[model samples]
Target: MSPTVASTGRVPVTIGAMESSSAASGGSTRREATRQKLYEAAVTLIAEQGFSATTVDEIAERAGVAKGTVYYNFASKSVLFEELLRHGVGLLTASLREAAERTAAEGGNKVDALDAMIRAGLVFIDRYPAFTQLYVAELWRTNRTWQSTLMVVRQQAVAVVEDVLRDGVAAGEFSEEIDISLTASALVGMVLVAALDWKSFQAERSLDDVHAALSRLLQGRVSGCR
Candidate 1:
C-alpha cells in the first residue's frame, strides 16, 4: 500500500494487497505499523533525495525506528522500495477500480465513470504527492532493480482508465476515432503531471479547481456534445 503524504493531512490509508498478505503471515500490528513507518519515510526521502542518495539510517531516523528495524522489515533498501512500489501502485489501481465500479452502480454513464476516476486520481495524488513524485521521476529511469516491477504496476493502473475509454467507444459515447489505449495512457499521465504541478507550485488552488481543469480537458476530448 502506498503511504499517503503526511502533508495531505488525511487519515492513514490502507496498503491494499500488502495488508492482507502481511496479516495472513501472522505479522503483528506492531510489525505492520513499523513497516508503514518505513514506507512513509522511504517514499518521502526517496521522493526528495532519490533512491540511491537516501540511506537506511535516514529512513530509520525518519520513521523513529532503529536501523535494525529497517533490516527486520526489509533485507535491503532496494527491496523495501520495490515493495513500496507494489503497495503504492496496488492502492492506486484499487482506487480507480472502486471509483469506476461505484459510479456504475450509481447509474452513472461511462463518461461519468471516467470523470469520477479523474477525481479519484486527483484525490490520490493530493493525498500521496510524495509517492507520485517518486513514481514520475523513477518511471522512465532504467537500470534500477525494480524498474520492471514499476512498469507492470503502472500498466495495471493505466489499464483501469483504458477499460473506461474502451467501454465509451463501444457505446458510442466516445468518438470511434479515438485510440482508447493511447488515450488511456495520456489521461493517466495528464492527471499525474497536473496533480504534481498543482501540489508543488499551485498550493493556493483548491482541489476542486484542479479537478475541474482536468475534467474540462477530458470533456474537450469528446468529439460530440458531452
Candidate 2:
C-alpha cells in the first residue's frame, strides 16, 4: 500500500490506486488512464465469467482498445491480472491504513481504529464490487499465476489489521493470549464475506446498516444476555 515491493525481488512495483490523477506528464497520464480502462474491463469480464474464459481480445474490446495496446501495456493476460490485483488491493490497504491513522490522530483507541478500518473496508467493497468478487475468488486458487502476488497484497491488507491488534494487546485493550495473526485474518474474512452478502442479496440495505451490524459483531455485543 505504501509502494513497498514484495520480497520476491522481481521488480519494485508501486502499489497505489487503480486510478491515478497525479501523473507527472501527459504521456504518463494517458498510460495510467489506459491501464485503468483495461483494469475495469478485465475486472468486469473476469467477475462475470471465469478468468480462463476471458481473453485479451474480450478485454481489449470491452476497454475499447486495440489488442496491440493490451500487449503494449501488459505482456500477457496473467500479468494484467496480477497488476490489477496489486492495484485494487493496494487501494484497499491504503484506505484501511488511513482510517486507522485518522482515528489515532483524533485520539481514538485501538478499538476505534479497528472500527474505522471496518467502515473503510465496507466503503471499498461497495465502490468496487466486481473487483472485490474477482479478488476473493482468486484468493484460494493455488494454481493461478497471480497466486503469489495475491498472497503478498492480501498480507499487506491483513497486516494493517494485525498491527492494530498488536497495539491493542500492548495497551492491554485485548487479551494478552489472543492470536493476532488468525484473529486478524478472521476479522478481514468476516468483513469481506459479509459485505459480499450485503451486496449480493441485501442490495437494498444501506452501507451504514451493514457497517452497524458488523460493528456490533466486532465489539462482541451480538448477544443480548450481557
Candidate 3:
C-alpha cells in the first residue's frame, strides 16, 4: 500500500502517516516560526533604517539567529522580503478563511460572511502593521515571483468568496445573475483599498466602525433586493 494509510479497524494497520505528518508539521511550524521572527526583524529594521541600508546581518542580529541561518532560510535580501510578503499574505488568508468557515458553519449569509472576513483582514493588519506595511510597500514592485505569489493568494481569496456567494445564490439570498467570482474579487479589492486608506483613521475610529462601513458597502453592492 501507499506510505500514507487511512485508518481502519482498531489495530489493523500502520501509523506511519500520522507519525510522518506529526513530525513534518512540527518541523515546518518550527521553521515557519523562525522565518517569521526573521521577517519581523527585517521589516522592523528596514522600516526604521530604510531598506537600502538595512543589512541582513543586522536582521540576523536582531532576530538572534546566525547570519548563515538567515541565508539558509531565505536565499538573499530580496527573497527574504518576498517571503515576508508571503508571510503577511498567508496571515491574512488564514484569518479570513477561519472567520469565513466559522460564519458558514453558523448559517450566516454570504454578505454577512464576507463582512466578517473583511473585518478579520482589518484586524489582522491592525495586529501586524509592520508586516502589513512591508506588504503594501512592495505591492507595486515589478518582481515576478512576488507578483505570482500574490496573484495566487488573491485568487484563493476570490475562490472562497465566490463559493460563499454561489451558496447564497443557491439559497435564494443573492442574485444568481451576478458573476460571483468577479464580484467576490471586487469586494475584496474594495475592502483592501479602503482599509489601507483608513489605517491612519484607525487611531480615531474603532474596528466596529470600520466593519460597519464595509458591511454597508458590501450589503449595498452584493445583497439581493429580496
Question: 1-226 in candidate 3: lDDT tens per residue?
Answer: 1232123222211111112234645456566556656765777676556666889889888777899999887888878876565555665776788988898899887777877888888887566655555555655567555687767755665676777788889989887798877787688777776776676555667778877888877767557545
Please report, in order, the local distance difference test score of every candidate based on alpha carbons.
Answer: 0.84, 0.85, 0.68
Error of 1 at 92 (Å): 0.7
- Reference-based TM-score of each model: 0.88, 0.88, 0.71
How displaced is residue 185 in candidate 3, in Å? 2.9
List model 2 lDDT by residue over 30-125, tens digit each: 677677667777887898797999989999987788999999999898999988888888889989999999999999999999999999999988
Candidate 3 C-alpha error for residue 93, in Å: 1.9
Off by over 4 Å in 3: 1-34, 45-54, 64-66, 140-145, 221-226
Clashing pairs in 1: 1-15, 1-87
Full-model lDDT, candidate 1: 0.84
Per-residue error for 146 in candidate 1, Å, reads 0.5
Native-to-model Cα distance after best TM-score fit, residue 30 in candidate 3, in Å: 7.8
- Show model 2 residue runs off by greater than 4 Å: 1-22, 224-226
**Cα shift from native, residue 104, model 2 (Å):** 0.4
